[model samples]
Target: MNTLLIFIGCGLVTYFSRASFILFGDRVKLPETVQRSLAYVAPATFAAIMVPAVLGDDGLANLVPPSPQVGAIVIAGFAIAKTRNMAVALGAGMISLWLLQWVGL
Candidate 1:
C-alpha cells in the first residue's frame, strides 16, 4: 500500500510538471540557449545508448570487433539517413541482424 502511494505520488508529480509547460507556455519563455540544448538532447541520448551497444563487448572486454553487429548498425544508420524514419530503421536493423544470425554470423 505504501509503495502504491509512492508510485501514484511520483506519477502525479510527473504529470503536473509536464502539464505546467502546456498550461503556461506562452507566459514562460525559456532562454534560447536552453532551447538549443534541449533540441540536442534527443540525438545526444540516442548516441549515448547506441554507441555503447555497437562498440561495447556484450559483457566483457574483447579484442576482436563484433563485425556482424557493427554491420547491422551501419545498415540501420544508412536506413535512418535515407528514410529519416526510426521505425523503418529499427525494422531494417532487426531484419538484418536476424538474417545475419540465420546465415551463421
Candidate 2:
C-alpha cells in the first residue's frame, strides 16, 4: 500500500511538472535568445547523460584499449555522418558491435 501511494505521488508530480509547461509555456514569454537556446537542450542533455556512461570515470583513457562498445560508437558516428540516417546509424552500430563481440574483441 505504501509503495502504491509512493508511486502514485511520484506519477502525479511528474505529470504536473510536465503538464505545467504545456499549460503555461505561452504565458511565460521567454526571450528570443532563450527560446533559440532551448533547441539545443535535448541534444546537450543526451550528451551529458550518455558521455559519462560511455566514457566512465577514466574518460578518454578508457578508449586506450580496443573496446567493442567504442568501436561500435565510432562506426555508428561514421554511418550517421555519411548517411545522415538514424536507422542506418543504429544498424551499423549494432552490426559492428555484434561482429566485434563475435571476434572476441
Candidate 3:
C-alpha cells in the first residue's frame, strides 16, 4: 500500500513537471546564446561519446597518429556531411575498414 502510494505520487509529480513545460514553454523565449548552445549540445555530445569509444584503450585516452579508427572517422564524417545519409556512411566506413584490414595496411 505504501509503495503504491509513493509510485502514484511520483507519477503525478513527473506528469506535472512535463505538463508545466508544455503549458509555459510557448510563452517563454530562451536567450539567443542559450539557444545557440543548445543547438551544439547534440553534436558535441555525440562526439564526446564517439571520440572516446574510437580512441580509448581499455577506456583510457590514447592519441596516436595513423590510427585506423581516425581514418574511418574522417571518411565517415565526409560521407555523412556530403550525402547526409547515415546508412551509406556507415556501410562505406565498415567496408573501408575491412578492406584496410584485409590488405594488411
Candidate 4:
C-alpha cells in the first residue's frame, strides 16, 4: 500500500542518516565551521518544535488558550536564567502551567 511504502521510505532514510555516524564516526573529520554550525542544530530543532506547540492555536488557528502557555514560557525562561538548572526550571514551568490552567488565567 501507499502508506506502507511511505513508512518504509522514511524509516530507511532515518536509519541511514543515523547509521552513517555509527559506521564512520571516527573516520570522519569535519571542518571547524561545520562543527560550529552543527552546534546550532539543537537549538534550531528545539525552536522548530516549540514554535508550533507555542503558536499552534493563537497565532494560526485564532483559538488562544486562557493565558498560561505564554506565562509558562516566561516563567521557565526566568527560571533558567536565574537558577541555570533544567530540572528546577522544568518543574517550576509545569507547576505554573497547571496553576494557571486551574485558575483560568
Q: Give the winner by lDDT.
A: 2
Candidate 4, 1-105: lDDT as tens digits: 699999999999999999997887889998899989998999899889986786655575423443677778778889999999999999989999899888877
The TM-scores, one per candidate, come to 0.67, 0.80, 0.62, 0.70
Alpha carbon deviation, residue 36, candidate 2 (Å): 2.2
Tens digit of per-residue lDDT, candidate 2, span 1-105? 699999999999999999986987877888899989999999999889876776767778768785777888889989999999999999999999899989988
For the record, the alpha-carbon RMSD of candidate 2 to the native fold, in angstroms, is 2.2
Better of 1 and 3 by lDDT: 1
Models sorted by TM-score, best on top? 2, 4, 1, 3
Q: Compute the lDDT of residue 99 as modeled in candidate 2.
A: 100
lDDT of 4 at 101: 83
The candidate that achieves the highest TM-score relative to the unseen native structure: 2
- C-alpha RMSD of each candidate structure in angstroms: 3.1, 2.2, 5.0, 3.5
Q: lDDT values of the candidates?
A: 0.82, 0.88, 0.78, 0.83
Q: Report the lDDT tens digits of candidate 3 across residue range 1-105.
A: 699999999999999997985888898898999988988988899999998777757343233443566667778889999999999999878877677667655
lDDT (10s digit) by residue, model 1, range 1-105: 699999999999999999998987889889999988998989999899977877666633321545567768888999999999999999999899888777766
Q: Candidate 4: how many backbone clashes?
A: 0
Show the lowest summed lDDT stretch of 10 residues, model 1. Answer: 58-67
